[model samples]
Target: MTDQSAPDERGAPRLTTREAAELLGVKPETVYAYVSRGQLSSARAAGGRGSTFDADEVRALARRSGRRDTSPAGSDLAFRTGITLIEGDRCFFRGVDATELARRYSYEEVAEWLWTGELRPGARFTAAAGTLAAARRTVGALPAHSGSTDRLRVAVTAAAATDPLRFDLSPEAVLSSARSLIPTLVGALPTLGDPEEAGGGSLARELWSRLTAEPADAPSLAVLNAALALLIDHDLAASTLAARVAASARAHPYAVVSAGLGVLEGPLHGAASGLAHRMLREAVDRGSAVPVVADHLRTGRRVPGLGHRLYRGEDPRATALFALLEDVPQAAGALAAAREVVGTTARHAPLHANIDLALAVLSVSRGMPADAGETVFAVSRTAGWIAHALEEYGERPLRIRPSGQYTGPRPPQPLPGLRTTP
Candidate 1:
């Protein structure tokens, strides 16, 4: 229980100078020094004791002295924040280089690295592994031959329904959510078995494992796992931003995750990969992909799988995904061909493939069903969305209200007992 009597008029509790100094981990005299420095406000004690300071003041001082402060270095924006930057050339997760981990480690290791900032080369899952298994059973009950996108939509929504504790955003809870959800969603893929066995490892690992049905070869599984890890997160994309915004409103993790799903339901974001797939399917049906692409360019004048709003030259993620797609037969030739066609026609357009286009190529090359590309995209983006949501939840409340520019009449005036003619 908290002390109610200590609070002043505004409900902010007043702390004695000793207590304030204790909170700030300084000497009692240092509290007086802080008052002299204009950093703290002090009041004369009620019963003729020394001065007392507001608890809020003491709390602020404690926050200011914390080891890992995230107050913005410099920005005019209200919530200027030090975004966790994962450098990619030498490749870092948070701050540690990921290339070393990626080369020698598994997707599970990478996920741990991303969430904890510490590279646990050998972390055992005990209870989390069991939770993942349960989630897989729930996913396996889903219709196997269902459209990948629809299945994902159904499964995620349903799984979220069963999870009552997703509202808690504690590190352990959120991490558990990630571990459980990734496997469950990934395990729900059609080829990953039905309620009986599923595959080897977690959902992300299982999905990667099933990507190559060639008797569970080690190298293939590793490549697939690497792909999943590489695709897991990106900076604040639209869906991720939506999730973060939802989280900022103190929405539950499930609701925040659902917000990402809602954004992904939009054609311009999550469905973009599906659109790219359809465009390819249309090109293939017409016998020659290049000519068909050229004709579409001539008519629509808009290239489907090229150009990005952010990257003027080339999307770095697209480049990375293309590199990962190199050995996969489903992606190898077709992606190169599509890139060539897009490059030739959209020369002036300067269109560069975004992450969606690259994922589409990878999905198609791997013989994943048409909707698999979108399913994978949604699953991958959720990681980033959850990360951003966690970040938003750590900060002060945000105010994102909408106001109209008012292109209409100022205010409606009531007629005085007479009807007006148009």
Candidate 2:
């Protein structure tokens, strides 16, 4: 039994049932109801007269119960996720600084770290020969104009079809599939020469060759690695949420990834990089960045690469990437144009250049295709989606189901419903 007259560890008083009920503005029976529902805690009273509750707990409950219930439209909803945390202008993955990870670690290492909480160096991301062949054939079947992301989606679908073990949802099996899937996806893309030539190296090297004809120099490879690491995950993004929802249904990993890709293809998500690329290219072509920024702002539309919903200052990923891009000779024009845009936009708004702008700068500098940034985004985010899927798989199946608040017109009376089909 808790001491009734004595103080708590913090010197707070314990309240009797009558006192708790009075504090909460409810009957004594309601206090018991709160305890039964696990919303409040109680202890045996001194001399076994009755139960006593912590005064602080009672006060907290009272405050919560008395608060207004105003649900704003499109307001942030709370859900538990341990994947990534966006704080101020920076992002962290599992408490590790993402910018630091991008600079020091390979994409494979980062993926493993995010997936299993271990960052093993020299981990291989190789695909089975048969799976590689199947993915290549799938990519080859697409039309000539198919974008890189489209090829990736097709390859994932094909790989899933051929892997007999794809149904395994165990953590080890899912991670094993991912290790092979990422490398195979990279190798499967159509390239100028044999894709095999691009196969035996870090994922960044492999992807670099597929995106452009340039040799995988050290600096370029570093930028690619950093980009991949930075893009690997962002907590509860629309695409990641979709992936989690699918996994909550106990869908296989491949299917979960496909669901994520379906959402990532939208203009406002993964494809935002492509839009930013075009806008930056326009500025570079015009020889002055002000006009492009002015046009976008004058239209009252969001400047594609300039702002983020989460960050109030320069995006840390953008800061990291821009610092790297500054040393590359080819990036000079695009970097200068980006600065002009940033300077001009700062005068009228608070938005700053985000990772998309940095991606556009990289693509322009490297002579990659306009959609190359989106492909990088999609491939990198596959790791995050897989991680989130693993998390969702451990939860109760279909737990994300949300109920709607009905605001539509009520059903008409029988006379009005008489014309309805039987």
Candidate 3:
């Protein structure tokens, strides 16, 4: 039980190291170890003292020490999901190692496996004629300089408008829409590659054509395909959360994806790879990451893609991508630049390379623009958003809503003008 007497800033009593240690049945130092391993989050105690853990979070962690965390009846904020599990700095999709899935299957296959339990070999997703046409028509009207995600937002809404059965929330209906909508989003982008390859075939190939005019080689396409599979989901990310909220409110599948796209536009989320892309490109141009890394640090900017909040070590996605890039001769310089970036930044703080740096390597080597990574992320993560929507559709409608904790001034205060109306 938590002490109700001393509430922390979050309106609940916070746990000290000793309390958390006792709760977890571990030594005080072990509590800090969990913090470092990203198993738990901590903050400084009041008055700049030692660390403090959220009482509810600590209890939740303790209960889930063996498996995944599950909230009690009243803890509506804690949720349950079976899609993606991030354990021991590794990512798994449906209990299968994600990197392995990325290796053995294509993006469509992995997405299919996530949506359904079965993996269909050589699965192909084709956009509907009407949906693709509508999305293309809508995206064409966007400003010339609009980012890929902006075009995607417009395309999804238009795609939804074209579908008469979009409101059907049944499993089969949602699945059909997902299969069509994903490719439709890719088809909406103006072709930068062979027009023949624009609408279908490999999703990575379709997206590649849109990102740059550079020809897609086997090895490079391999890397891009794996990236899409690897990025399919990451367990209730900001965008996924938004998508789930929309689904909880009984929004249709297209609207659910639109909600996710809204959150993905944030710099800290979808645009992260764009930042890393620019940084890695500058390092490649300079022929050394030292100055570029120095410029970032000297200007008080983070060396983009250097770290992730979830992993205490190298992000597994980065490790997988870097291994694949090693086989591509075109990626050597950009890959080296990425290494130097890690080495340079590690000197001041031991932040390891994250997926953004790996994505930067791909975009820089492939001649894709800075925003190219954002497009890859949006298209890839669409599957995940769909999966979340599917899950939310099974739950009671609007059950995810949380009541606000009122902290504002009491209502009925005198008006600013204090005018007495007759």
Candidate 2 per-residue lDDT over residues 262-349, each given as its tens digit:
9999999999999889989999999998899899878987777888888988899999999988777788999998888898889898
For model 2, the stretches where C-alpha displacement exceeds 4 angstroms are: 1-77, 192-197, 407-409, 412-422
**Which candidate achieves the best TM-score against the true structure?**
3
> What stretches of model 1 exceed 4 Å from their correct place?
1-105, 122-146, 192-197, 208-223, 281-288, 346-348, 402-404, 415-422
Where's the lowest-lDDT run of ten residues in candidate 2? 67-76
TM-scores for every candidate against the unseen true structure: 0.67, 0.82, 0.83
Candidate 1 backbone collisions, by pair: 91-98, 183-203, 307-351, 307-352, 330-365, 331-365
Q: Write the per-residue lDDT of candidate 3 for residues 4-62, one digit (tens) a residue.
A: 22467658787888888888776777677667545578887666667888888788677
Q: Using alpha carbons, what is the TM-score of model 2? A: 0.82
Ranking of candidates on lDDT, top first: 3, 2, 1
Listed per model in order, the count of residue pairs whose N, CA or C atoms clash below 3 Å is 6, 0, 0
Error of 3 at 88 (Å): 0.4
- In candidate 1, what are the lDDT values of residues 77-190, reduced to their tens digit? 122223333332223457644444545666667667666666687652332444445555665676656556665655566667667897787877887777666665665555
**Residue pairs in steric clash, candidate 2?**
none
Residue clash pairs of candidate 3:
none
**lDDT of predicted model 2:** 0.84
Model 2 lDDT at residue 300: 86
The weakest ten consecutive residues by lDDT in model 1 span 72-81
Which of candidates 2 and 3 is the stronger one according to TM-score? 3
